[model samples]
Target: MEYCDGGSVVDLMEKRGFSTLRIGEAVAIILQVLEGLTYTHNAEIPNVRLADGSFAKGRGLIHRDLKPGNIFLANVGGKQVAKIGDYGLAKAFDQAGLSGQTMTGNVVGTPYFMPRQQVVNYKYTQPDVDVWAAAACLYVMITGYSPRNLQDQDPFLAVLQNDAVPVRDRTSAIPQPLATVIDRALIDNPDIYYKSAAEFKQALFNSIS
Candidate 1:
């Protein structure tokens, strides 16, 4: 693993008391993350073995844990670059044969960043989970607060009840166009949410244009 001299985004936020970053800086970091996800979601690795001892030629991976803590910043080519890390919870699934729930019976990922479908059905296989989590990260970057501050409540119940306040409601300074994109990503209905990281990135870019 390459050394990240700048450390994780969570560390920076904690040290700086979660101060909001400049809009350009925030968007840049988000775009880097989205770019990384785009590769991970589309890359095809060969000769992969599954837990069932089955062999497969190619598969796309889902980074189940995608909070700020799992994202690191490093100075590369004289510029700070955000990179996804901590793949301990990553899962590989067949993108071509995406079938019914492949995971269940246990909760995964950070509560504040998890999507509604992930909480209700852990086995659900869809790239939207990461999209939603990335949106939560964006919310933190802009407002310095989690989309839902459910620290005191049961995370499962909080997500089930859809207790998060809309990003627009939390801060009026956010541009309405950007706020709309973030709000759409936070939607519980997977069908209505950003379908892929590339799609989400495009919407984000459009907001700042």
Candidate 2:
């Protein structure tokens, strides 16, 4: 793996004293992450070179864990670039069907960035879970707080019982169109929201452009 000398997004947040970043910085980071996710979600499974100089057909991958801590920054051509990291919880979908459990009865992921569906079943999670988490990361960067309240309640329970706090509710400084895009991405139901990173990225572009 290439080294990311600039550190993770969480490090940047901490360095800024947990204050929100400028709109441009936050959007730039998120756009980079979304681009990475677009590629990752559509990556070919079992993407390995065979001894006979052949390859096998495959399916998409689901990155079950995505948060500011997992997004690293690197200095590339004098510009800081955001890159997705830590795929310990990533799972590949089956070639036969998009739905298949990689494991059973396992709950893994940062509660602050996870959606309800991921909390319910991490093993059978889909790509949209990553999109939700990406939005959560953006939300934190813009609001200095997680989308869900994490104060006095059990984190896991809060994930299951609470809806994501609207981006504008945390701070009205966010433009309505941008807020709408981020808020929609954090919706608990992946089937109804951005089903892939490409979709989420397009929505973001449309909102800003």
Candidate 3:
């Protein structure tokens, strides 16, 4: 994983364009994370595959504990990339439909990027939660700041619940199409969120053209 090293998305944003690689290379790394998560969410069973597939495909639920310290950042030529790390909270979804009722565990995900349903509702699904986190992470990488509501315990949850502020509101400079893409991704609705990592990537690519 160190070979694919780059600091946390936060660090990368602070020093964007500082990498030794070109922008295309940086985009490739971001796409890498997309492809990796896509496989885990769509095909691999919970706890099956690592974000980068170091271990065997897993079963059960994957909490995906994301944090600043856990993630790494390094200079990739002239590009900086965000690498997923630390699977301490990564667990197998062993239960049947999460105890035949709730779709996920009560204690899951980081405050800044987790959806509200995960925190407030017991029936949230893993795919939706991951989508929200992915969008949030992308936001941090692009803006160089975590979309946290310091006033609340979990700002990401706040965003999910209210559905009032779009990602664009937080950063006015964001292009309309890109902002819309992220807005749909971060919301609490799985139906609207990209069905798979590939779909999400395509939408991003489509928006540019």
Candidate 4:
């Protein structure tokens, strides 16, 4: 909370367009958020339930609902940091060990971040799903626009089922490598994308380095 700011990233973007940022600065902002989530998942969080199998951390604490509004922005003295806030209403659940499922309260994340299965009432892992939302947010931040146009009734379905537009189509300013990261994150194939925030953070830093 030390880096806390009273405004959201969307507020900043609207006031000052993101299209002007160089790819390096864009990666820097994204790396900060990814690293933060990675740290939390890697920490010893108390009372978090584990998936009955595999014994690996079950997506840590699944943030059931992550959206531009729920996200908070702060500057570690002008370096932007994002935190998953409003956990007061989210439900964390045990992850699938090797491959199994469990009950969580039936609710879709915000229309923009909501993944397809969630909209259809399918059970999904907490952290895995959280990774999905993070990926979506990443797209918005770098492009100054939502990846999905939000022009449809079922935004998640369109976003999830339809192939993602080429990142170049999304933004000429986005570098191909970083855009590739966002593309993989929102892709239909899980094996092609990072399953955890930690994995995504590593890829991001790799790009920067």
Candidate 5:
């Protein structure tokens, strides 16, 4: 791991003397994270044979603990690149079952960013959970508050009890298109949720474009 001179996004917020970062800056950083996630969610792991002597295809990895504090900024060729770090809670979905560190039915993640489904089934959480956390990071970056207000409530129960507040509700300055993208990504329902990081990234791109 290389050193990041610009520090984490949390550090950036502190340096700015405000929790919320400029919308443009926050979007830029999150776009990079989405790009990283696009690759992570579609990674192909080789050399694993399937049931009938056939190698399995692509493998997807989920970073269950994605937050502003875990995203670090590094100077690369005069550009500040946002890199996803602290993959301690990362899980890969393949034919070999859960990875080494994964424990079935045990919840482990930052409550503020994770969706309710993740809390319910952390071991089997899919890539959309990471996408939701990414949106949560963006929410805090631009709105200066978490999607759900967890004050005076048990952190664990808060995740199961509350849905994310709409971005525009927290701050009306956000444009509807951007807010809609964030809101849709944060939806906990299975039927109408962003299924993958690429899906969320495309929605975000379309909103901006």
Candidate 6:
């Protein structure tokens, strides 16, 4: 493990007061995380064995837990780089056995960052889960708060009830287009949300351009 002298993004936010980051800096940090996910989601790894002693390669992995605390900042070449860490809840999906659904009765991931699908149907592996979580992270980065409107109600219940305020409504300083991108990524509809990390990255880039 590389030493991240800069510490977690959450630490930085706390030290400087959240929502103090410049738009470019916040977007750059988030793009780094998305870039990491682009590789993680597509990387091939060994799959678990089946009852028949048969096994296959898993083509996609989901980072069931993604939040500010899980993201580290390391100084690389005199520049700080955000890196995704903590794979404790990561799960792999077999491409050959992908039925668009996986069984799971228990909820995982931080409550504030979890997507509605994760709260409603814990039994499934979807890349969109990370996408939504990443957007939640972005919200915190830009607004100093969770998208769930934690000040008004319990964040866990808000997530379970799909009660999230639009990013634009939370922070007017954020560019409307960028806010829209984050909002769309946080959408509850997997079919309509950013489908892949690459797509999410592109949308983010477009927002800044």
Name the runs in model 4 displaced over 4 angstroms. Answer: 1-3, 17-22, 42-45, 48-59, 77-79, 95-105, 120-123, 190-192
lDDT of each: 0.79, 0.83, 0.55, 0.60, 0.85, 0.79
TM-score per model over all chains: 0.89, 0.88, 0.66, 0.73, 0.90, 0.87
Clashing pairs in 2: none
CA deviation > 4 Å runs, candidate 6: 49-55, 95-104, 150-155, 190-192
lDDT of candidate 5? 0.85
**lDDT against true structure, model 1:** 0.79
Model 1, 131-178: lDDT tens digits are 888989989888887887676678778877755578778788888898
Can you tell me which runs of candidate 3 are displaced by over 4 Å? Answer: 1-5, 14-29, 42-63, 67-82, 93-105, 121-124, 144-160, 189-192
Q: How far is candidate 5 from the true structure (C-alpha RMSD, Å)?
A: 3.3
Show where candidate 2 strays beyond 4 Å.
47-57, 95-103, 189-192
The per-residue C-alpha lDDT of model 1 at residue 39 equals 90
| Candidate with better lDDT, 4 vs 5 | 5
Looking at model 2, residue 40 earns an lDDT score of: 81
Worst 10 residues of 6 by lDDT: 95-104
lDDT of 5 by residue, 28-88 (tens): 8999999999898888755434445465554867889999999999999999999999877
Error of 1 at 78 (Å): 1.2
TM-score, candidate number 3 = 0.66
Assess the local accuracy of residue 101 in candidate 1 as a C-alpha lDDT between 0 and 100. 28
Worst 10 residues of 4 by lDDT: 95-104
Select the stronger candidate by lDDT from 3 and 6: 6
User: Candidate 6 at residue 104, lDDT?
Assistant: 39
lDDT of 3 at 180: 83
